[model samples]
Target: MTSDQYIIQRKVNIVELGATLGNISDACRKLGVSRQHYYDIKQALIEDGIEGLLEKSRRSPRIGNRVAPEIEQRVLDYALEFPTHGQTRVANELKRKGVILSAGGIRSIWLRHSIEKKSLRLKRLERWAAENTNVLTEAQVQALETAKEEKEAHGEIETHHPGFLLGQDTYYVGYIKGVGKIYQQTGIDTFSNVGFAKLYNDKTALTAADFLNDKVLPFFDGFGLSLLRTLTDRGTEYCGKPENHPYQLFMHLNDIEHTKTKVRHPQTNGCTEKLNQTIQEEFYAVSFRKTLYTSLEQLQTDLDAFMDRYNRERTNQGRHCRGRTPMETFIDGIELYQKLVHKGELMH
Candidate 1:
């Protein structure tokens, strides 16, 4: 029984003992309670029944800064639409719509729902997409496939060092009137959050191999590190027979192992998905409106500059980066990579 029930039962025993003894003083002394305490308990029971015996809590009943239900609902609804967004970004976007909640307040709401982390919020969005796929927009559908918390608390995330596993993906960066249909090939080191991207007019095995040959390998080579394994979704550009397919052939030539995500679950390569979203929101969305691009090279040039800054300047809050730039994390991890390589434990 609960403590309250035990307390009430003991008080009732005191009352019964007094009757059996026919001496209030003797019964009170045996039970270690004063007669006055006994009378108070009896009176409380008579007046309000057993519920009166429950101990009163010392803390306040409600949180002082809890937002109203309607306000909390707005934050939750916004999370569904923008699962990749952090608390500050979420608050800023909400403020644009005239809602005046602070980032801390929005975070408090997220904590209550177990979605304070981007992965947790994405996990929730993943569930929503499963149940409402028919009505989801293009972006929402992408978000669903983009990230899932591989947490034991929620999903399982493997700890990796630099050059361990790089996640790669292709994103259709919307259509431009004069530039034709644009696509981006993206890569991210799962350990350090270091990212790379290149834009092209076509999605093909040629571009996929070119991304690794040109952008990815050179950077790692500069650091004396080797690119080990790559993770990607099952796109035609990534998966094919090693005999003639340019992308598969490239992997075979480089001695790099290839890994593919589950058939429909793109979130397994969440690092690249996250990088794609970052470039989409922080770069392309703003750039497309500010200038008129006449050729693919113009957009590609701007994309390269932004990615340089992202690697060297943008501080990340990921588990490994922890407020440092991706380049910093990448540099720090090189020592660990070398140690593992020397021990002959770096192989898949």
Candidate 2:
């Protein structure tokens, strides 16, 4: 029962026992309720019978609110027409029809008698496990065997030095309440947990080009690196003929050596992909508690603050600079970069 119901039940029981004992104070002290409350319950019971002393139902007395049957059917029909439209949009549509209802009220009515889709996107393993009795196909078995043998020979991740590799990928930042869906293009340096994100309207070549030119170039330039090997997914944004692709042009301009992950294989860029989860949990989830930004400029400002906190304050898990933040590690890396540059050493 709800707390309200529980309190009323306790008060009613106290009054009943107090009447039997012929002392209100004795029952009030034992029950830890005021004598006024005990007497109130006794008077309620005497006037309206025992039914009045019992807890009343919290469910609204009104039937399905004041919304007419015809209006509710119209809301359902509109929802059916556009499956992607959420409760807020449905409420707005209903308001245009001269029917006023709060979003929560509309959602309650919509959910009461409708089939709803789950919000989460199912992973491949979950889908495969549900469909097949034996989860792994023969092709998957062969690929796993090959990967295991290679890993056994090569050992684990090379966490020894800097400038070894850099990984890149795009992650969707789910649907924002006011702004539509957007992708967060991200990059992670292998040696350090230092990463950056640039929001994109879509996963197009032009947007991908902006990430390469505006975000990636300035970072590499700050560290005085020109020719580093970059890992990326073979999506249309990053691959295709150089003549037709913008990422090709940008990479060439910046003298960046490029490598692509195998088709249908995400594990190749697993480090950066895992970093995407960190971005979502640490930045997006935390920022929602404060103001939610609608414009791109405000969103970028919030992202910059989040990135600063992530790199300067947060600690890495298993790498060498365990206690130090990514920013501190990055500073240490800069010292190494300057020393190399001074010693007349070629660096990538």
Candidate 3:
């Protein structure tokens, strides 16, 4: 039964129990409900019968908590105008138009109207245009056509072992007093949360290749593992016509397949993006001001120490890992995959 129906039935049971036990106070105490609440239920039953025990919606019709109708309409119009924009961008656009809305509030409206994804929204608009072609303006039809033609890309990569897939990306870690400008190149194992990061004075194709060779490859090699693939964005540092990109050349030499994210879709490389955010909040933001680094070597030294703690000490609460550290999860995944292979249930 629905929760509301269950609650109504429970109230009726409580009233009956009070009558049977010959004590309203005893029934209220046993049911953990206030005596006043028991009386209210009993009175409702006396006046309106069983229908009165049915729970009504608590939502207020004229409540100020609900989004204003005009504001919601403006949000819908803005979303239609920019079909490719995510909730954050939509909320920012509304803010610029003097319609302040939190991302959660905007998402709630989108969910209420079933505008979950850009592609879904575009499809709805296309249907509307098809149905009202005679009434739609020229500009409205053109907007619908453009949205329909836009490609909708969604992808997810699964890793069965630690070296099955790796996601790499670079982030600007800000300029330090003595270190000048710093750029951090990071790589994370998709199956395990194990990550490696190196700070460079500049972000270039050569630096990106060096980070993979000097840090990422060597770390995996120490564990007697080989990376199957590396995923990155189409930044100049990691992409080109393939022959000229140093990072691409490095991957080719190592026998690792290099995969780039879809154009304008950074969520495809979300693993490294999430790692960058974690490092920014947990490491750089907390330690950058507190620690004094006189040279690049010093910063690199501290960064290496932090990476050790991140891999071996910090317990990951991810769904796959539970409370195990990244190293522990990596080892567990390898063991499970090996057992499955031995049982002839999985191919190597």
Shift in Å, residue 100, candidate 3: 41
Minimal lDDT window, size 10, model 2: 147-156
- The ten-residue window of minimal lDDT in model 3 covers 143-152
lDDT of 1 at 268: 73
Which lDDT tens digits does candidate 2 get at residues 1-348? 977678667766897788888888998888888888877787887888766776668785567455788877776665443333456655655665577877786676656655343121112222333465444344333322232111111112443234546677877765554565667888877667677788876887777778767876677677766436678888888888997688888777767777887786767777787677666544553343234457656777888787776677655653655656666776677667567668867345
Each candidate structure's TM-score, on Cα atoms with residue i matched to residue i, is: 0.58, 0.51, 0.55
Off by over 4 Å in 1: 1-159
How badly does each model clash, as a count of residue pairs?
A: 6, 0, 0
The model with the greatest TM-score is 1
For candidate 3, report its TM-score: 0.55
Off by over 4 Å in 3: 1-156, 337-348
- True-structure lDDT of candidate 3: 0.75
How does model 1 fare in lDDT? Answer: 0.79
Better of 2 and 3 by TM-score: 3
- What lDDT tens digits, residue by residue, belong to model 3 across residues 1-348? 987789888999999899999999998999999999998998998999888988766764546677989988988876664454568656755665688999898888888789978667665655554575434444433322332121222345667777878899878776655567778899998888899999999999999999988988888788766777888888889887668888888888888898888888887877778777666644653344234456778878888988897888665655566667788998887777666557865422
lDDT of 1 by residue, 1-348 (tens): 977889888888988899899998999999898999888877888988888766668576366567888889999998876666678767766775788988898898999899998768766865675576534344434433343322211122465689888889888876655667778899998889899998888999999999999999998899888898998888899988889999999999998999998876666776677778788755654454334567889988999988997888766767898767789999899889888889988856
